[model samples]
Target: MRITPDTLEIGSTQKRNKNETLETFLKRITHVSLVGKAIVLMENLNFCKNLNVLYLYDNKITYITGLECCRNLTRLYLQNNAIEEITGLDVGLDRLNVLHLHNNRIRRITGLHLLPSLEHLKLDNQRLDPGEQLEFDGECLLALASSLRYLTLTNNHIKDISPLEKLKSLESLDLAVNSIQDVEPLESLLSACSYLSNVNVLGNPVANAGPPVKLRQRLILASPTLTCLNEKDIPQVERMFVENMRHAQRSRRSAKDHNHTRDQTTSLGVSGTAGVATPACQEEKPFPHLPPFASQYRDLMLSQLTKNTATERRLSDSNLHISPRKVASAAEALHRD
Candidate 1:
């Protein structure tokens, strides 16, 4: 059914169709839903100052306006719309606690700095390009950092999330189906947001980098306080076991590298010592008292005597031999000649 500003009670129950004035309607109604009506603009809602919950989702609304009088609003659902930007929400949403803006054309996260009481925010399924990262106004988010607890930005083409480190009170975060390729930024969240326990990164590149079991173990190791990952609860025993295993692996690798380096150093040292020792041992002179020329001549005479002995052996085998005295006499005669 179509519901316009003038015919606001078209789809409402019979109690709200009792021909009541706008003031009476505003005073009695606490919740309203004008969904699936192709609504382009929000009007005639200024009298709804007492409204606590409003659902205007699945419409063609291009902007957020006409809600400045809803100061008592706590929950707002504006998802599945054509909203290109977030504005006009700084007026009367101080009491707003929950906001759902999923499936919209929003590219930048803004218009939330004044919402000091905001707790849960969902902005998933935005109209973003491939490889396009979600941008944020750090100052705006920082203003609400303390009050924000649950944040869902899934499937928004987001890659960098360093700005979220300031959300110290954040408890649950959903960042699935994005382009986050690194888990280091998330590690910071563990320390910054002491209360953070649940995290969803199911469709990111980091999640697909390894097997599911290993990924879970790595994430658990990264954040020791994490109790849930990708909607699965992580038991304390599993976390402890993964941490211990990682520690043991690191120790083994370190020891192996150390031993390898030591072995290489020892082998080099032994080879160097052996090379020097062989030369030093051989350099020790056996005949230090002998003159340099006399030692050389003595070594030559011994070599000649040894050659004569071998020649005599060969001559005897042929039935011919020379006596030692004859050999000596021939040597002296040759020397004289």
Candidate 2:
């Protein structure tokens, strides 16, 4: 049966007056909630001209159709269904900001490039054949580069998330319980998507391969914004640990550069007297290209904090279970006002 105007009037949370008929109530309604009602077809929803959000999940809906007129629709929750493909969404969903299509049978992702305002897209846990991974459309990834942020692509048998490099504005990524064996793509994402803060790759082989603490530290340092890994919250001590390491690296680099410059000046020295010598070197203005995360990391990088490797030592104590409190205590004295 079609999602008729009467069905919508009944499903909507907007209270219809006793005197109001189904036909009159449907015209003014802005949202519809038709969950687990044994709905078989997605038809007759165009009557709600001012429709903004649609919650039509947990039903027997097979195919996505009949949403061609929802131009103002911003959020669509159609998860936990038998939907086999991603269709009927690109027609007039330009303003759609959120789309939840997880726990379905959609094998390939398409028609998402049309959503210019999409920010959160969840396409996880797809029902696929054994050993089959969910596929993506390349154009869709490029279109989601600027606006798309939070993404959850879990349990799709996906071994690679290299396409996520294009989603520059992504803040949180959940790739849990997948077949991802290599984290090089995730490592690259730290630079590509500087806004990425929370990542959940808990059940992946890469997360279980190496030392968990070191892996956490390496990823945190790479992005400077990552505060959560495998569902564990990263505290201030771990962040301070990275800052100290960064400072140590910068110091070593500065000293090495200074010594190299001094050697170059010594090589170009000119003898003036028996014990006096003159060296010449050129001086100019400085220009440095900073990463996108520099300003975004201000809340993380504190200026008053002195650099120390105490937290680093604490992390070395356990490769598996990292205690942020213990790590923080190692350098607690330095943080006192």
Candidate 3:
């Protein structure tokens, strides 16, 4: 079935009355079910301006087309099809909320930056050529940062999920039975996207072979907002303990970072005094401050360096020297020129 105007009524949920015109019939169509119809080309039916939900799964649809008129479409099911690419769902799909394109031949997931209201996206079991890993579009990820909530990329053999870190609104993520071996990117994603509630990564060659308790502990530490992991519900008491552990670890991490920065400063100061080297140089100026630092500390550092340079007649001062503050004061010469 090629979805021509005459054959379009075969799967329509709307009934054309005895005297109803084609325009009126098209307008009345809010749902269409053409599953298993072996639809090779998606054409015609462009006048379904009021179509809300469409079901075209389990068919031979090779490409996504002719949906530009379904501006009111919200739920679209194109799974279990032969869709080798993702398109035709971008233009004028402002109200689309759910899309199912799983079990297709799509290798690169793209052309979805236009759907700002998209919430649920399923691209599981993508049929790709051998030695092909699922890829994502950067622009699409950025557009879905705020609107996307539920995402499923299961069985796609995706390894690096670092690109999904910007999807901060994700609440439930399903990456089960994939090839993800590292949870570091997932941890980073959790750090940015704190709204994740249910996450599934089972059947992946992750650290699941370890002790169950250890794995549970690691997941709990990874995301405190999670209530379910690999389809297993986490108890409230366990969540509390994990939150406490995360807080403790966060405090320890903060202290460690502070000490590390201080140690680096000390080492760099000593090296500068010995006329060897300093912190990684992005510039060759008087400021010996490390190039990589939090922006909020820049003001404090600038004032300190200016005070040291003006008062003590030295361009820099650090922990490398003794009695750094006792050297001189800017106010010492206040009574003079």
C-alpha lDDT values of all predictions:
0.78, 0.78, 0.79
User: TM-score for every candidate vs. truth?
Assistant: 0.72, 0.72, 0.71
Consecutive 10-residue window with the lowest summed lDDT within model 1? 313-322
Query: Residue 235 CA error for candidate 2 (Å)?
Result: 2.5
lDDT of 1 at 330: 48
Off by over 4 Å in 2: 246-337
Q: Model 1 — TM-score against the truth?
A: 0.72
Over 1-337, each residue of candidate 2 has an lDDT whose tens digit, in order, gives: 5577778888888988899877777767788999988898988787776788899999889988888877888899999999988887779688899999999999887878788999999999999999789887778789888999989999998886777788889999999998888767778878889999899988888889998887777778778788787898889897998889979999999999999986654443422122434243322223233334432333243321213433432333122222334434434434442
Model 1: per-residue Cα lDDT at residue 68: 80
Where is model 2 poorest over a 10-residue stretch in terms of lDDT?
313-322
Candidate 3 lDDT over residue span 257-297, tens digit each: 99998777666554455564557742233434332332234
Best by lDDT: 3
Tens digits of per-residue lDDT for model 1, 1-337: 3345445544333245467775676655678778888888888777666778888999998899888888898999999999988898899588999999999999999989889899999999998766566778888889888899999999988888888887888889999998888777777666677888899999999888778897777678777678999999998888888988999999999999999987765565444333435455334334334445445555566566657665443333222223434445445555566
Off by over 4 Å in 3: 243-337
Candidate 3 at 27: error in angstroms?
1.8
